[model samples]
Target: MIFRNLNWTKNGLNINGENLNHLRFADDLILFSEDARTLEIMLQQLSDESVKAGLTMNPTKTKIMTNSQQIAHNELIIVNSEQLEYVKEYIYLGQLISTDGSMNKEIERRITNT
Candidate 1:
């Protein structure tokens, strides 16, 4: 999701499928999917979108985690040092709360979506 004042002039990434969720505020984009294959495809599409938008997805800053028990190391959240579990809130200053109270005013101010 986009944050701060960074300009995301490029077009946002668009993926098609059922039960897929995507959030884009500026350059910061977050997506979620239930199916494994769909998630994989979405990531691929994200890479393409990054290229097309002239935005670079920093490999070192990116993290991919799987929730399935069979999937090893399923706890990383890309571009963020904090664990996925810690991201239970996304505070948006002066805005309505969204999704499980993740939208905290302090958190939104701290969120630096480059």
Candidate 2:
């Protein structure tokens, strides 16, 4: 609801330019972008909106994963003046998404867990 006025990411697959940039289920929010710059902008906007709504983002619980072909070792994304930790893979909605955009590890985990 806080991002109603914000611009979303476009996948370039639609003729009307309508694409999903983020997903909201309950209190969890997942934002996606093709580049770090755009992602950072989105994060900053989220942070600002959260503050305006009397909410705060937990930096420790925030994780960033990139699927870029060339990994950036020095890329830093800041939220509320603190840098978020970059992870090789992240679990969202019970699915593991890796930096390389592969689900092989996620499948293995699911099998092992089952």
Candidate 3:
């Protein structure tokens, strides 16, 4: 349901010639972008559209992650007037995703869990 009426292709992350902007599994969703401002726009657009459907969003449960060292500080990504949280790493679907863009942490986590 994200990016219902916005042009997100221009801002999506490209890897190995494939552009990826979001990943969705049932109700769980993850959005990706190279720039923080563009991401903010996407979230805003999603928020506006969700309102029309009478669906409310929970900003507290939302999270923002990035691989840049500068991180997110310029403009706060607020949906429903609430700023989202930023983290160094978060688990998605069953794999550990880190802002460092490395698989080492996931490997270690799996090893420890096993």
Candidate 4:
């Protein structure tokens, strides 16, 4: 609900019908796809849209993590580029979403504790 000007599109993929969206963000842009191929398509679409809108997609700031295990706040667990078995985690927004499917229970508890 942050980027009120951006549009929303239907993502025609499902893994157990979880609550999901193709793209979600407020001031910054966060895009999601069902798979790697779909993610590629989405990225291309983003590039095209940006071009048409006179906006720019910062490749330096843009990051792609394929085969995502799960997405909580916005972070991702992505396999390392150099190592196949190595996985890395990142945080997006203010929540911790892990590839292992863990939620920020402690943060939620703290918020409610007050």
Candidate 5:
């Protein structure tokens, strides 16, 4: 997608002072951003670009998660004028990620699942 024009998450693995954004695996895409506004912009841009490429984003299946402890309430993320679902925890690449940035739940899940 043509999402390079929009701002993205720059929180990990800085290469020469450049931050990396998101992780793509197969058909799944995970976008990351520290702020809700940036994420909102990115999501909107992605939706627009995907439409141009004959692809559509499923608002129902799309979810927004944050690892910020300061955020006590769920933030509304809109795409295509629809509000995306906000989840406190999400499983990505078989790893559980929580809004509080703790792996305790993930570990417990794995243990129970096993």
Candidate 6:
């Protein structure tokens, strides 16, 4: 697989015994990896392939979020030499997801928007 790292050193979030590494919906994509190194490798490979297909990913538009405390705040992932931002919270599939994995913000957003 292009996205799967051969020597997997970490695992992503597992739900009901399923380890999810990525999710793609339409034009939106989310990558999951417990190891920062693995995530970076996947992202680099994706960026390279996208370039080969005549697509350029906007580094400014890309964001990274991590729930693990092991990941340092300064650990920013760069694509095409531009650094991506690390966000504490962001909306995914119209639902707010926080790096801390809190649902409070999403709940409040739903209440106000509903």
| Error at 31, model 1, angstroms | 0.8
lDDT per residue as tens, model 6, 1-114: 334423333456677887777788876889888767778877887787777767767776678888888887688777778887888888878989987777988999999998
lDDT-wise, the better of 1 and 3 is: 3
Candidate 6 ranges beyond 4 A from true positions? 1-19
Summarize candidate 3's per-residue lDDT along 10-93 as a digit string, tens digits: 767898888898888976778887787778888887778878778766786678987775554554777667888887788889
Error of 5 at 43 (Å): 0.4
Which residue pairs in candidate 6 collide? none
Cα lDDT, all candidates: 0.46, 0.76, 0.78, 0.50, 0.75, 0.76
lDDT of 2 by residue, 75-99 (tens): 8887778998888887877888887
Give lDDT for model 6.
0.76
- Listed per candidate, the RMSD to the true structure in angstroms reads 10.0, 2.9, 2.6, 7.8, 3.2, 3.3
Go through the candidates in order and give the clash count of each. 10, 0, 0, 0, 0, 0
Give per-residue CA lDDT, model 4, range 54-106, as digits (tens): 87666545665544454332443232221112234445675544555556764
**To one decimal, what is the Cα RMSD in angstroms of model 5 from the true structure?**
3.2
What local lDDT score does residue 86 receive in model 6, on the 0 to 100 scale? 86
Candidate 1: global Cα-lDDT?
0.46
- For residue 7, give model 4's deviation from the true position in Å: 10
Q: How close is every model to the real structure, measured as TM-score?
A: 0.41, 0.79, 0.77, 0.51, 0.75, 0.79
Clash pairs for candidate 3: none
User: For candidate 4, which ten residues in a row score worst on lDDT?
Assistant: 77-86
Candidate 5 structure quality by residue, lDDT tens digits, 13-96: 356787766777875778766677777887888788877888888987788876676543466777888988889888888898
The clash tally of candidate 3 reads: 0
lDDT of 2 at 96: 85
Task: Give lDDT: candidate 4, residue 27.
Answer: 42
Off by over 4 Å in 4: 1-12, 15-20, 66-87, 104-114
